[model samples]
Target chain A: MNPQPSLNALQSILETLLPQMEQGKFSKVECHFVRALLEQFKNHSRVFAELELSTRHLKEALGETENAANTLLTLAEDLQRDERTEDIGLQISEACAFQDIVGQRLKLVQKTLYSYVDFLALMGTTTQTSPATIMSGPGFTGEVISQDDADRLMG
Target chain B: MAVSKDMPILIVDDFKTMLRITRQMLAQLGFMNVTEATDGVDAIEKMGQKDFALIISDWNMEPMSGYDLLKHVRGASKTPTVPFVMVTAERKPENVIAAKKAGVSNYIIKPFNAGTLKSKLMAVLGPF
Candidate 1:
């Protein structure tokens, strides 16, 4: 009995038998989950930005309303109430414009979510290997997809 | 700038937000007379109805990609000189080469800002 081949010798023998260990790495499903999570992170970021902009717009509108109220209060006492109503109207219009911006941003976020749905579908259908090549946004990653690559990955 | 702000410009994209954002970017550049089409076929229909001073279009679209539209525009009679700019989420060199070979005036990638849009337009329209 050769001491049952020392533990170090067993470790070296195992390394010789299998040089690559694929077991420890994340599977395709796990990778998909990771990619999807990253995508959600991006989606949340967009929503957060939208919310910030919306809040700014709301604040502006509130400030405008307050200005109008105060100015009207002081002016009513002085009998100049009709003078600054136009200013209030203009401010309201500007504030309303913010709604349009928020509307567009929300729509953009919706589109992003829709794309994410397609990605989720791909993840579900793909097997053996990660279906998507982990496509990257302009600044997020460097790989570019061509028409041919797109067809293959999509398949 | 040779191109006037009043000149009609056509923008084609599949996304509504992109259309609005691109229009807003153009507006920031003093271009108020901008028109939009949701896809290539829609853009072709619009193009048939009017002569745009400049045409800005997205590259990826269903049933008819921007490359196909570019080919149609390039092959169309009496519309050879129309400046066509292709915008895309894609940055593949092959697409860029194909677009340039098809006579695209300028190419810009997605996630672009006001500055990139402005510079790309200026490259095509000559310092607007």
Candidate 2:
């Protein structure tokens, strides 16, 4: 019917279904059924674009953290030479702020990476599942297990 | 300010950036004689070649860590009693207690500023 809809249309349907999937009200059978629908819609160009963006964010966040560390080192040297203890303290505070920002960015990147992995698994293109997916597996397998079991089995 | 220019200081850290930072700080404090080591094994080897007045080491490192280095140094007859400082990311009370029990002369937690380093050095060495 309607040429089985394009990949983009299927992906949109899956995207719309995500909120329901996350609501936690769905039974195992219902979840599996929705996941099967997601599998049918996994190969959209938009998903690949999102994955690329997520990877870039991860790299950027890591680079920022490294750069902040290096800057702190240089500031320490300057402060020591001038015997400016107060300034050194201020710089350290600034460095810590950068560290906090980097941590937030890393979290965002991690979430995006998780989403990308889930998208990949839904497409049946990836045999691997994200460590984030504890109760889920390929083919919409509705397996309820402990956190430890999910960690060992998924990653 | 208390350290002598001739007194050799050993800086140990896995990250080159940290080593450079420590060296610069020491230099500013007027300690001209400084040596570098990547980890505990390298620090021990270097210490064997020449005695160091002070050893500043990072706690976490690959192969051999700072704790191991401190133990090795204290265990050595020639190096025993040498001033040792642990610079580390771990600032927990238990970690500090362990390092103190291991005979660390001073403990400087990571993200330390120049003032903290200077104060620690002065506390350990006294005013020059």
Candidate 3:
């Protein structure tokens, strides 16, 4: 699957969220958590960069193979066809290497998210305000729905 | 002196991914002699090692910001005349004015493509 759109979405979310967190009237500890979350996004960004570089290398190889294909068409030898197939296989192997890196990154993101949620829960219990309310602050306008509302919307 | 593609260029960002992406973009522009630094302090250390032809730095970083780096670069006798470009996601007027005052040669916003990078390099280096 193409990671471009997902990466763009993640980037957009980060761009919109960071400045607000920086400017928000959150407590010192809350701001510390926010900074840690930003660090987590750095890991996410690395995964996306690795994916982009892998795809770019794969595309470059395919472009070269296309140029070679023009010459191989006239030659039409079994050996040339095998070599071309091998080149594509090598690209696939290179792409698979990226899959391992992405998997590791995803696990890291998941762990960070869990820790953030736990921190939010702790804050909610201590502050007597929901995590969403604390996050949105006073003038936030984004559409935020509770789990019940989300289920109703899904129905 | 005319800009040469092989001239050493320094790119500094706290984000490793941004450093990688900027290096790739520079490579696409046929600039292969690029150095990466994680932040302003690291950049200053690298500057001590080699005289970079150009420095492209992200504005936001912990401990030492790109703005501070710009000030340091301009104040230092060794690299005072080198072209300095600031890359930032923020477009605040005051920040731009401050960077200009600090001797930034050019500035580029974040999420820029290779074409934008090339254009910024051209503006600073006078058509490389």
Candidate 4:
């Protein structure tokens, strides 16, 4: 058996070399598939980078949200003794602004994801199954059978 | 010149949410006087109408970017010496160099908090 190159490493190498190969001789289907694959790879790389950025932003947003919630909880606990409640309230408000930043970045991520799906469909790689017919959850689509109905069917 | 909390400050960003966030953060830092611009062009228009003590602007925007705005600010103007802080998601050395060449007083990366904002402001405007 021959050793195989890592897909992760191969992707980067191909990304650099594919454009040079774009002008090479090939059949119609081969050309189409190659170009589509190259495009898909670029789009995947972009989406991956966007996802990483969104993940970082989300982590920061969640941390700030937790801080705000904890501050509020503490203020609620020591309502009578805390003199800096107003300052803490303002701090919480400032901390909650993380959602706006995260929301903006996540919107970019969502747009890139949608573009990925569109690219797949364009390349004729998408399945024939209608989006509505696809399973949304474990038990969401199937019929709700009673225990009696199950027993009767089994019997 | 002493940096006063009462001095008018301008924040330019394409995102309304960011404008709100920056404004709220500045308010928390005791800087009550603040103005906003949606883009570099708008910021220039605002600059024409009034003088800002400091300018905090996002690097990316349509029609005119923050780099363009910085150049315009640094160009022949009454407030040419005003401190310009570049806020951006880009961390590339080339970007920092370009901003420095364009006369940016300071730089700030996104995903920053009020504390970070305060530190940058202090660096640019001196202690408040």
Reference-based TM-score of each model: 0.49, 0.51, 0.48, 0.60
Judged by DockQ, which candidate is best?
Answer: 1
- How well is each residue in A116-141 modelled by candidate 3, as lDDT tens digits? 56545654234222222111111111
Ranked by DockQ, the better of candidates 2 and 3 is 2
Model 4: CA > 4 A from native? A1-68, A71-81, A117-155, B15-18, B24-30, B60-68, B75-79, B88-98, B109-119
Best by TM-score: 4
lDDT of 1 by residue, B90-124 (tens): 56766677787888888876545566778778877
lDDT of 4 by residue, A50-144 (tens): 55654555565566567657766776566567767666655555555555455545555555556556655655563231222111110111223
CA lDDT, every model vs. true structure: 0.63, 0.68, 0.63, 0.68
Worst ten in a row by lDDT for model 4 chain B:
B88-97
lDDT by residue for model 3 (B19-120), tens: 776777787678999999988999999999999999999876656879999999999999899999887653455566678778888877554556667877
* Deviation of model 2 at A150, angstroms: 38
Ranking by TM-score: 4, 2, 1, 3
lDDT of 1 at B28: 70
| Residue A100 in model 3: lDDT | 25
Which candidate model has the greater TM-score, 2 or 4? 4
Number of clashing pairs per prediction, in order: 0, 0, 0, 0
List pairs with backbone clashes in candidate 1. Answer: none
